[model samples]
Target: MSDGKTIILNRIREALRENPAPRPHASHTSSDQEETPRDHTPREWLPKVGERLDEQIDLFARQSEGLKTEFHRCGTMEDARAILSVLVAEGAWKKIATHTTPDTSALLEKNRAEILKTDTGYQIDDLESCDAGITGCECLVAQTGAILVSAPSAGGRALSVLPPHHIIIARTSQMVPDLTAALELAKERYGNKFPSFLSFITGPSRTGDIERILVLGAHGPKRLTVLLLED
Candidate 1:
């Protein structure tokens, strides 16, 4: 093999050694004489999560709560708008940043005076000072309580990660049982080509780096809120 390929392989092996994966099976059984040899890697790696959409959504909410993420379920976009309006009014968030995606952009339209919408008279630097940010998500991975975000769906990676308070506006149809299912959906959506960045966000940014004491918003948003649009 080429030197570059060998080096890459070595790094991968080292990473595997540092954090070993669970053994799929204790031992392999001897194959029957008439049986054909087959690889089960895909099956082993992508085991069935065995959850319906509602079950997955429940699990997602529970896990997100464990991470201090707040959830608001809305039957319609108007309900979602009311929730956001209340949040801003009560929390005293003077300025807000959101992506240009149609869903979020439409929501922002009602409260244009407070929005920091980039390129529509708003700019990137304004987001740093904005009290909160909002964007649409690609999918909600229930198994891990993660919101799958990509550049195309979310508008900009920076808009998702840079704000102190991050809000996700997503529909119930985006729900999936697990990471594997979410990835498969993304594959179908993007085909061979994909966005520059896709992020799996579980909750607010946190760390236990300073003497193991819990810290919120250590590197990113201090709070995360999800507005799930119910059918």
Candidate 2:
């Protein structure tokens, strides 16, 4: 065998001799004693989150920048509407897809583009053809800069994923510190009848498997924009 291969095999054999493998189902203690459970807390490993709202928002913004998410903090619904209008104009969007929520409906009332409501049902082809998808989120996670969406809160599943651009209209009240808090909020909001679909979207879809070169929109929306309005 090659010198490198022989050296590796010799090291493996030495390690095995020094540690001798234990027999199957070997027990050192009495069978009646129960084993201690492993710790399941995630906060032990996750990044620290601040208690104040402003700190959380700042962290979220920084994380969003790293993820390439377009995040806009609007002082009011009017400001959010203005931003949406600008996006529509810039993208030259002819049609947009959305589910009807009070906030979303009001924001898009004066919008010139044709609106396709996906709440009831919609054709996949029609949804795919839309320039953008607008939906309300279940919550925004500050820790990971993720937008949580469920079938009930957002328009089913396809509305947020099929369109080229995904727009999220959220409120400051919907922001949470981390995934644990977000899950708790969801549990509190929907006790027994949880929605069939729930997802945490961190950023626009991307892949870099082909040539180690990043490519966006490979599997989903090319752009993710968040318009967070003050409550």
On residues 1-231, what C-alpha lDDT tens digit does candidate 1 reach at each position? 579989999999989887778645535565654433345434355534545777777888888889899887788888888888888887788889876776787567576347776534455578788888898888998877889999877767777778798999988899988887788998999998998899999899999998999899987999999999875
Q: List all candidate RMSDs to the true structure.
A: 5.8, 10.2
lDDT of each: 0.80, 0.90
The candidate scoring highest on lDDT is 2
The 10 consecutive residues of candidate 1 with the worst lDDT sum are 34-43
- Alpha carbon deviation, residue 181, candidate 2 (Å): 0.8
TM-score of candidate 2 against the unseen true structure? 0.83
Task: Name the TM-score of candidate 1.
Answer: 0.78
Q: CA shift at 206, candidate 1, in angstroms? A: 0.6
- What TM-score would each prediction reach against the true structure? 0.78, 0.83
Q: Tell me how many residue pairs clash in candidate 1.
A: 0
Error of 1 at 47 (Å): 9.2
